[model samples]
Target: MSLLAQLNAPFMYLLCGGIILFVALVCVFFMIRAYRAGKAMGIDTTKMKRVITASATFTLLPSIGILLGVIALSGSLGTPWPWLRLSVIGALHYETQVAEAAAEAVGLQSLSASLMTPTAFSTICLLMSVCIMWGMVFSVFFNKRYLRRLGAGSKSGKPGGGFGDRAMTAMFIGLICAYMGSYIGGFVSGNGLFRCAGSWIPLGVVAVACLSMAGFMWLYEKKNAVWVESFSIAGSMILAMAAAVGLSALA
Candidate 1:
C-alpha cells in the first residue's frame, strides 16, 4: 500500500476521532468541575464569564497554530498519532523535533511518504512516545522536589521568591538564543528546508517577524493602540508566514 494510503487509512481516522472525542469529554468534565468549584468559592459569575472569554480569546491564535502543527505532522505521521501526541503532552515544535530525531535514529534523512515503512514509522512513534513519557513521569513524580531543591521558596508560600525567577528568565533567554543560533547557522550554511533567492527563507521570515513586532510595539506605545497589544505576537507570526510564502514565490 502507498504510505499516504496507509497513514490516512479509515482505521487511522477513526482512531484519531475517538481519541479527540475522549479528550474533549475529559476537558468538558474538568471545566464543569471547575465551574462548580468557582461557584462554591463564591467567585463572581460576571468575573468568571469575563475571565473565560478573555482566556478563550487569547487562546484562539495559539490554538490555530497548534492545529497548523497537527496538519503539518499529519502529512508525515498521519492524523491519529499527531492528534494523540499533540492533544496530550508535547508542544508543537517539540513533537516535530522528536519525530525528526526518531527518524534520524533509524537512518532516515527526513520523513517522507515514499521513504517510510510501517516498522520505521512505528519506531519513530515509539521513540517520540517514550521521550514524552519520560518527561511526564518526571514531572508527575519529582517536579515539586526538584523545585524545592532549587530553593523555589515553596515552604514560605512565596514560590520562586528570589533568584529563581531570574534564573528561569535566563534559561528561557538562553534557549531562545540557541534556537536563533541554529537558524543563523542554517542561513549561513544554506542548509535550511526553505530557500528563496539564494537565501534561507527562515532568516527572511525571522527578519520580517522581528520588524513587525517592533512596529507593533511602536504602535502600542506611540500610537497607544490597545488592540495591538494582545495581538502583537500572533500578528507577527502571521506576517512572518506570509513573508515566507512571498519569498518562496520569488525564489
Candidate 2:
C-alpha cells in the first residue's frame, strides 16, 4: 500500500477518531466535576453557565486557526494524522516544524505526500510523538515545584519581583525572535531547496502577520476595541496564510 493510502486508511481514521472521542469525554468529565465543585462552593449556576458559554464561543474563533493548520498539513501528512494531532495536544508551529525536519531527515526535500514512503512516515510520526512528550513529562513531574518557587519569589518582594511573569515574557519574545531570525536568515542565505524568488515568501508572510497583529493591538489599545483581542492572533494568521498563497502563486 502507498504511504498516503496507509495514512488515510480506515484503521487510521478509526484510531484517530477513537482517541479524539476519548479526549473529549475526559474534558467533559472534568468540566462536569468542576461545575459540581463550583456549585458546592455556592457559585451561581447561571454565572457558571454564562462562563462556559463565553469560553466555548471564544474557543471557536481560535479553533479556526487550528482548522487552517490541519488543512495546511493534510496535503503532506494526510488528514487523519493532522486532524488527530491538532485536535489534541499539538501546536500548529511545533507539528509543522517537526514534520518538516523529520521529512528532511528521511531524505525528502519537503513533506509531500507524493514523495513520502512508509518508512519516512513512520519516522516522522515517531519523532513527533517522542520529541513533544518531554514538555508534558516535565510539566507532570516538576510543574508543582516550579509553581511553588514562583509563588515564593512573588511573596518575597525581592529585587526580582514578578520574575515569573518577566521570565515568561522574555521566553515568548525570544521564541518569536528565533523564528523571525530563522526566516530572515533563510531568505538572506538562500538556503536549502527554497533558494529562489519564492524563498522570500515566508518573510513576506511574517511581515503581513506582524502588521496585522500590530494593527489589531492598536485597535485594542487605542480605540478600546475589546473584541479585537480575542481574534487578533487567529485573524493575523489567516491573513498571513492568504498572503503566502498569493505570493507563492505570483512567485
* Highest lDDT model number: 2
For model 2, the stretches where C-alpha displacement exceeds 4 angstroms are 152-251
In candidate 1, stretches whose alpha carbon ends up further than 4 angstroms from where it belongs are 1-14, 22-78, 90-127, 159-161, 191-198
Query: Model 1: per-residue lDDT, tens digit, 145-174?
Result: 898887663667554557778888999999
Question: Which residue pairs clash within candidate 1?
Answer: none
lDDT accuracy of residue 94 in candidate 1: 90
Native-referenced Cα lDDT, model 2: 0.84
- Using TM-score, give the best candidate's number: 1
- Model 1 has a clash total of 0
Clashes of each: 0, 0
